[model samples]
Target chain A: MKSRKTTAWIALCASTLLAGPALAESHGMALSGDLRIISDMSNPAPRAVMEGMVADFGEMHPDLNIELTIVDREAWKTQIRNALGANPPDVVNWYAANRMLPYVNAGLFADVSDLWEEPAFEALASTKGAMTINDAQWGVPYTYYQWGIYYRKDIFDELGLSEPTTWEEEKANCQAILDSGRKCYTIGTKFLWTAGGWFDYINSRTNGYDFHMQLARGEIPWTDDRVRQTFANWRELIDMGAFIDDHQTYSWQEALPFMVNGEAASYLMGNFAVAAMRDGGLTDDQLDFYQFPKIAEVDYAEDAPTDTFHIASGAQNMDAAKEFLRFVVSTENQTKINAGDALGQLPVNANAEIGDDKFLQQGFDMLSNNASGGIMQFFDRDFPAEMASFGMEGLQEFMVFPDNLDDILARLEDARQRIYK
Target chain B: MFPTPIEKRSRAAQLSYQSLLPLALILWLLPLLAVANFSIKPESDFVNGNYWGLPSSFDLFANYGRVFFESNMPRYLLNSLLITIPTVIGAVALSAMAGFALGVYRFKGNLLIFFMFIAGNFVPFQILMVPVRDLTIDMNLYDTKTGLILFHIAFQTGFCTLFMRNFIRALPFPLIEAARVEGVAEWKIFWYVVLPLMKPALAALAVLIFTFIWNDYFWAVVLTQGPDAQPVTAGITEFNSQFRAAYHLMSAGSIVAALPPVAMFFLMQKHFIAGLTLGAVK
Candidate 1:
């Protein structure tokens, strides 16, 4: 069937070649690799952005002809295993941190550390840490967006409140909001990953980014004092009724109804949630975005999941893959991703042209200003798939039954040992 | 027909049946109605908290146009057709033979052979995924539409044979005997005698297999990676970004994807109706 499709394609190519001799001119192009777009990256706007970038690369390199493959993210998780186990694609779309670590360690991902030394990539130095395993950079990150607490600007104005810069102030604000008969923060744990967002913010705020990173890597035991401290803070928020009721029943999208309808004031979410909030009929003036409130006096690292690209270890076209990677992080191609109805991400290249969307600009400011400390990919991204799946479930279990924390931790720790071993 | 037609029932019973028919259909079609609702709507209707209300604007052309021109829905539809048609043909053809052997033959292990096909139906598909994928990869058929079609044919043959065997068994055995007594060859008896009478069953089984393979999402994803073999069921998800889901576009793609099977049913309406009403009339 594939051969039939190929034959049909060749037939069409032949027809086009006959109809227009100019089409045959680019047949000299030698650079080709399969650049995959997995998950939500399979979107039309994003895919168009990527296809445009690929076309742009063809114009720039003359010999570049990368075949862009967009696989549904759900299938990619399993398809990737088979695609890699046999003959890996020239370049594949994958996430940063522990997600990439296993593939890199197993020599599935080609080391592109030399690309790190390029002067054009100087601004992307912070993103490299997430893509690195054992001090060796394996991939080049292209897209990452901010994950922050999206609060009600109108509520802040009405209650004469200010954005909390510290954990105490955040708690105080939550208490004040609740005292006034409103919910403080909203989260939907139905999908479980939203629970990971709360765990991430709390862990990052309480124990600092290092501990959060360690916990994700299974380097820190789940039963550790610091891990307990993170949950303790989460428990306090639970006790304060900071999160809305029956959050376990609602997805993150479902949880937006509370905030959008004005029953809830704040929600710690990524920029993507902004699209949802607007969809729920909230105007831009009503909502304000802020970085998650500070906890202990730790360096300000945040959850910023970076979508990255890597050359396959078994790639038939290493030079083309490297060339494609270089083109991707270039200011031109990177800016194309941020252009036109595509604020779902912030381009990793600082030199890339930023779009004019205020929400996106705010995401840019929050990430850039807090860049003194590196970005950690969100929990699901920062951990291996199986471990991340278990972690999200553990977080969800905690949200549903906060008192069963110890049991959940022990179970996660057990899975951690089995998985990370 | 066995329960008796609604017209044969009492007035009050007929009234209940007539009243309940549309209600049951609507209930069954509620999810489909929602998809239809979403497909015609602009994205603003979803955001503005008016899901069940009349769409603010009818953007059917825009929505479906994007699905066809802007997105890969057409390619996916073509892929679905390529994969589904071949599988249905292969499964129905093979199962006709298998069902014949098991149903007509008085050989040893006839029940055992029929039971094997039935048992295959009971195994949960999830368990077969890994090994099936590994086997596909080993055979160098991984990521090809042929691989997906082959696996679908192989897996669906179990159900197909069960359906075919039961269907063939219900036919008159005297027809085959009469053909044999007329000095017709056994092969001719099976082909000209039995195959001609099996039209309704074939038509019924074809529609079932076509719909099953057409709507199949799991094997489409497992056996094929990209647009080369990925069918419309898995393809609609391309509108789903890791972040924001394009429900409107996905719905449009879904409607487009659902068109062929619907068209097939309509085109084969005569055969389908004839097959279903096999013993209805005295």
Candidate 2:
């Protein structure tokens, strides 16, 4: 019955959208003046997507002068504050969740709760909590990608093992892989955030999503018994020699060779790793995906780091800025921009069709149907900046020296008190 | 002699020296050779962890073609030229006048003024980064070629002035005295006599400053950004995308960015060597 209602509603939306000129007039036909946008989609493929969106949006509202500036993606992090504190552009790119907290509090991001009230935004319900702060929405997510374990199918087949579904099965599979003279997982903690991925999965699976987010919010101490349980769970695999040796020396890209060369059977990485694995000559027949298995019977809580667009609080062209954002989240625009040959990621709008790639399809299915607990914005984006830095460092040390757990937890507990204070 | 040449050593020692010299030379040049090798490799080779292995396929034309035709490298190279040429001229000209005044006039506090020029070189430029950036922003010159050129000229002038002054002091004094005795104006004595005599100093300083400004990555990053104003040194990082570093493309871009200063060195080899020692002894 719910599926039928969704189909009928989607049909209604399609009819109105297809009705053409009269509907378009109400949508955004009157937008004019210069609508400036600063995007951090500076990579070649995403750069084209941003420019294409600007061109199409300009064509739709011919009277509106749309200006687009693309900044280098990494440099934009430091420069965003300067851009927002002064004569800000109409729209700018940023991340979702706690990453937006500083700008929201500084009054740099405009409140867009009214936009969320519209029936059209229902398609983006999954990410609404991430976009909201203090009971109001600050931005809209455009794209996000899922995180999971990408394993070598041939290795699993040779060992007569299947994708693990629980903590017990996972360890048993790891032992089998070790017996076969391969590490169960390959990870690089050199830059320190890759270890945070392991923590996010283990912590979320060990104690449900609510407890994990509470920990992220610094409501719970790192010395909490529940938190130790998460570590104890992780320590099992570390103690079993389940991960590659000297992983602290490699970058995330450098860690890819282990899985590609069959020294490691799998990698617990984001969907982006599939491209690198493929570049390393791992064909689809050899590579496959599986969700991180159940622990403590908690529902699946997936990491899908979202990239968003927010209207500047000091926008000169408010109406046009809001309209352009609306245009950005429109089903057609999201579908085109996040297509396989474009940004090559999942669209935020549930109604938008996913790309035809096998990994993208599996990721979409897993996130849409299986991720009932929650969608986390990864470790770094979910936590405060200072805390995430300290947390990742501690996590890397813990991965390297499991015996240092006591000292690490105490230091983190101290950081939590200070940071959240 | 306390120490002898390689030929004066025993046979065993000479043999080791002959063999180890080529080994050391190869070791020293290995990194440069690796960069050249990487610049011609396919992008997939990096992903495949073939970093030190023979490239799976030669992609010299494709990679370099992308750097030249598809990327913003040409514009960045042009920006470097625009910034470097003006800075070299400005620094050399200002220092020539300042060097002439301090070297010839014997005015009050002339030695004090020369000491001040030498003192400016003692400052570590890294300490000036924040203040210099703020100054440019306040002057409304942030991210402009003029701002970079101005800063480069101001900062480089100190060393240039020191070099020019010492070189000018090394010149025979009677030539200037004779020019003065002919009732020629002081300015004419500078223009016709001292200036022509300072040609080698000017060439050495110009080549030195040109390379210095062209290769400056730290200030280039601090003072400017984007293709409109940034020099090739900082702009080479444009090859890194959000997730992955394009090592192949960056290697190609680095080679391209390095060519101008290298070409200047080769073309002005005499001036470069002379510039290194011109003011050191005298």
lDDT per residue for candidate 1 within B1-282, as digits (tens), equals 598887898999999999999999999999999999999998766644456878888999999889989877788889988999999999999999998888788899999989999999999999998999889988999888889988999999999999889888888888877877899987787799788888888998899889989999888877786576789998888887666667788898888888888988998889888987896853
Error of 1 at A230 (Å): 2.1
Model 2 DockQ reads: 0.50
lDDT of 1 by residue, A298-402 (tens): 888888888888777887766667666776786666777776465357888777778877878887877776755668888888877788899899898887789
Error of 2 at B67 (Å): 1.7
Window of ten residues with lowest summed lDDT in model 2 chain B: B271-280
Q: Please, what is the TM-score per model?
A: 0.85, 0.93
Best by TM-score: 2
Q: Interface RMSD, all models, one decimal each? A: 2.8, 1.8
Off by over 4 Å in 1: A1-41, A63-71, A79-90, A341-344, B1-26, B48-62, B97-125, B165-170, B173-191, B266-270, B276-282
What ranges in model 2 sit over 4 Å off?
Answer: A1-28, B1-13, B273-282
- Candidate 2 global CA lDDT score: 0.89
Candidate 1, pairs of clashing residues: A39-A73, A40-B241, A40-B242, A279-B47
Fnat per candidate: 0.32, 0.34
* Best candidate according to lDDT: 2
